[model samples]
Target: MASQNDHFASIDIGSHTIRLLVARSNEKLEIYPLRLERRITRLARNFQEGQTLKTPGIRESLRVLEEYAGILKCHGVSDVACGATGVVRKAGNGEEFLAEVRQKTGIAAEILSETSEALLSAKGVLSVIPRTEGYILSFDLGGSSTEFLLLDTRREKPLWHTSVFIGAATITERFLSEDPPPLEAVSRAVEAIQDALAPVFQAIGSILPAPPTPFPLQVVGTAGTATTLAAMNLKMTDYCPSRINGLPLTENWLTATIEHLVRSTLALRREIPGLEAGREDIIPAGALIVREILRGLKQTHLIVSDAGLLEGLLLDLIEKKYGRPQALVSPLTWRMQKG
Candidate 1:
């Protein structure tokens, strides 16, 4: 069992941003994230012709890692796990970049396989949603990739999983060349998404069993893209997970929201509730991605989950090293650590 004061950490180095989560698992079987931080590094922006981390990207990432290392040391983190996503995995020079990162930070980062990443994201999002019996599909849209997972509640197992290389950031860069993208360009982007998702849809159709009638299939949305959309739908002035998570979003509302987002300018988007400053540039692309996902799944409704990979990593660490405890830990303990 982990001691009351023992600290653990997980870092997710993504294409658009790097996130670090530090948590403490107490003797009472409680795990709380003590500190969380994210920095936008745009690592994938330079991965144009090939999978290579640009010189500026490398320098930025190294600086962030140096700072994060200091923070971990200050907090006395004992067990640490770091992982890289699309940019690193797809880059031709990924191995060399990762080697340098390890040498500099003393943290050997694991590049999570697409399936593994999908599963971890599903596990994390599921943890936050309302427990129910039926099939659930989880979607996580990122900067350089999008992951899909089907979870069978009846069997308590994942049924299917896949990662698509198309994401809001990447798609925006590819299609939104015009200040306000032309209608033709937008249509082309949609067509491209449909083409890319054909295989994923086929895979889902093949593996997912027919659901029992009367119980609608649940679709869960997580990550920055989903959360931001949920926030916009709810008309929040600022992002608040407590207000957004598990909130029901109907298909009609989703469609209307996407249309509204597509028609709005960046300046107008910034005025909308719950849209932060940094997200204005990518919100349109993100909204389009969400709209396509709903269309692909034939989903009529969605449930938003604010939690994802970070929480999943925490749970896995607890279960793997510390045996399951008999008593339940207070949710407040976990809540307090979000700072």
Candidate 2:
């Protein structure tokens, strides 16, 4: 309806990390990223259902958002879109925390509902993994919750989607406590993850149509857990987004890593090539969550998508500004074209 050519920013404040994506739009409706960054604050650290946002987490996230605000100022970006998930949505002090953010940084954050998180994340995941099968199952594994979205490529909307209470940090806190966790701890964690997923799988089965005239469902994973695992698989010393997209994470690798992570101490896990520093405590639990979800769906491998709600936030703003394009340029393709 109107011309839109301005820099925009999107922040996804999650249970475990705070992510920023700054981009500019063009006449062709393509997105060009000016910067991409993520910092682990564990906003839901030591969090449980119906809890308050922790003091330490609030402090750290505010610090990071201040830095993000500085970055936005450098880019001359005034229009910002933010979506807070998992911790923010479930916390009793969600609005208060947001108010503090607004007061300090002059940025307002919308606490995204679980379903909206799933849908936006799926769009971002779909944007990266080009030409996937008709039946796509995408999951974003975060600190306090995991969202599962089943999408059919031919359809405009998802077939089924839901968010569950279990996530990397929570599952580890509940079931895996030992550094270099014992076999018992690993076993118990696996059992609990399976139990939590059982009903979700059953509902999926009830609704799922036979896949793609013959093709099986395409599984894709997002958020910190998935991207970190993808990095580990590639033995990547530094994080890379475009390369991480559509990378296959196999069951054998998943199970082997699970075993290795369980046997290694937190300090030892940090030594591993791809594992980031702050994630050592929750990785074992995160791997198991990935394992159990795959096990339930009878899927062997999942595509790792570095892009998710973070990118989705930017795409959404572009649409709102210029209205939906005659054709959309997904974030991944835009990056490729910019190259």
Candidate 3:
């Protein structure tokens, strides 16, 4: 078994950003989150016409990884797990890129398949929420792809899952071509999303047994897009998951919020309550993608989950090494690190 003081880290190399989390696990099976960092590298932005990560994208990714490596060292991280999503999974040169990243960062990076990504995301959301006995939909919207999974809380397992190529960053680049996009541009984007989601919806429909009654489905959204929306809904001057997570956001409020965002300029988005500076440029695109997903699912409300792949990965590692938690990592540790 890994030692109590051994430091473990997980790095999520995503299309829009790279995130690293460092934690220490104790003999009592508690894990304390120590450090968190994120860098916006836009690794998928330069993908060539054939869906290959361009030379420039690889170079930028390497630079970001080198920086993250330094941070890990400072935190005394010994065991590392890293994964790439979306662009790398689809790129022809993905394997080659992964090799280069490992060489430069001294961290082996695995490219997760679509189904595995969906499962991990679902696991992360479920880890935080109260266990219920109904169907739960978990969605993670990254820069280049969005993953959807249907979890059966009754059975405590994922039932159906799929990954869609449309995501906040890519869709924005594809559809919101205009600054404060024209109404037509917005419509086109929505239409495109609807078309792309049709197959997924049908696939889900085939797998899910008809509801015995009209039960209100619980929806959990993770990743930056969801967190941004939740923060905006709360009108928080500063981001706080304690205030935002699991908060019930009604459909009317979400619609109103989206409409308000669509009318504002990027500069103005930064000034708005709950909107973070790093998210200002992409929030509009994210809003559109989220709004369309809700519309497609006919969902009126969703619970935001700040916990995601990182937390999921941590849980898996802990369980494999030491079984279920006898004691949780100190909440004080989380507060201090988050602050």
- Residue-level lDDT of model 1, residues 96-117, one tens digit each, is 8888988998877888888767
Q: Each candidate's lDDT (Cα)?
A: 0.76, 0.86, 0.76
Error of 2 at 283 (Å): 0.7
Tens digit per residue, CA lDDT, model 3, 125-156: 77666667677888999988899998766564
User: How well is each residue in 1-339 modelled by candidate 2, as lDDT tens digits?
Assistant: 434457888999998899998887776766778888889998988888988988999999999999999999998875788999998899999999999999999998999998889988987887777875568888999998999998777777788899999999998888787777789878888898998999899988887865555656888999999999999998999777888998999898999998888988988899999898899999999999998888899888989999898887777777777766422224324554431
Which candidate number maximizes TM-score?
Answer: 2
Residue 219 displacement (Å), model 2: 0.6
lDDT of 3 at 259: 78
Distance (Å) between predicted and true CA of 6, model 3? 1.7
| Residue 295 C-alpha lDDT in model 1 | 80
lDDT score for candidate 2 against the true structure:
0.86
Q: Model 1: which ten-residue window has the lowest total lDDT?
A: 325-334
TM-score, structure 2 vs. true: 0.95
Q: How many clashes show up per model?
A: 4, 0, 0
Candidate 2 residue pairs that clash: none
TM-score: which is higher, 1 or 2? 2
